[model samples]
Target: MGSPKRGHHHDLYQIEASLKEILSLLSEVEIDHKVLFLNADAGFDSENLRQMLEKEKIISNIKTNLRNNKTAKNYYYFDEELYKRRFNIEKANAWLDSFKALFIR
Candidate 1:
């Protein structure tokens, strides 16, 4: 979900705004199963985001830069198989395009 922050004020991540959005999105998600993990790509690798997700009891499996395995304070276990899944955004988008309901909105 990384994007050039579309608002006039520019930053890679406005920490406060990102926090609010995380909380809001968490609230909206109704978990039917035990939600043990939240996987994100290296772009989302951040200590702040990891800590927040920790507090909420979700395992933050954010991929790190090849040299930054220690940045997130050793709290997460990097699953290579899961991290590899983030590389196929185009396939996921194509799958979504196959669903007619996604075009309705």
Candidate 2:
């Protein structure tokens, strides 16, 4: 979900917009008895996103952004093991970058 951010805008804004589109697509598709999860960086952490994931029954593995409040206790559960697998997604994106011409068009 990472992309070039213009100016100082936060990633949460982009993710929020994308979520609507994603949920719409999900509604059009029929997924039966499958566990769904979302992996995102700390930059995308927010209570709003947490609520959205909760409502959709999607397991959220977003890292906590401790820059603002380092002493706050996170009530939300995070699975480090699953988050580690996010690198595989990054690798896939990196591989896709090699074919920039295909996407640019």
Q: Work out the TM-score per prediction.
A: 0.57, 0.76
Extract clashing residue pairs from model 2: none
Model 1: per-residue lDDT, tens digit, 34-87?
A: 357766777677777777667767777777755566454565588889767766
Residue pairs in steric clash, candidate 1?
A: none
Cα lDDT tens digits, model 2, 14-92, are: 7766876777666667553125888888987888888888877888888889885487766668898888889998899
> Cα lDDT of all candidates, in order?
0.65, 0.77
Leading candidate by TM-score:
2
Error of 1 at 96 (Å): 2.2
Top candidate by lDDT: 2
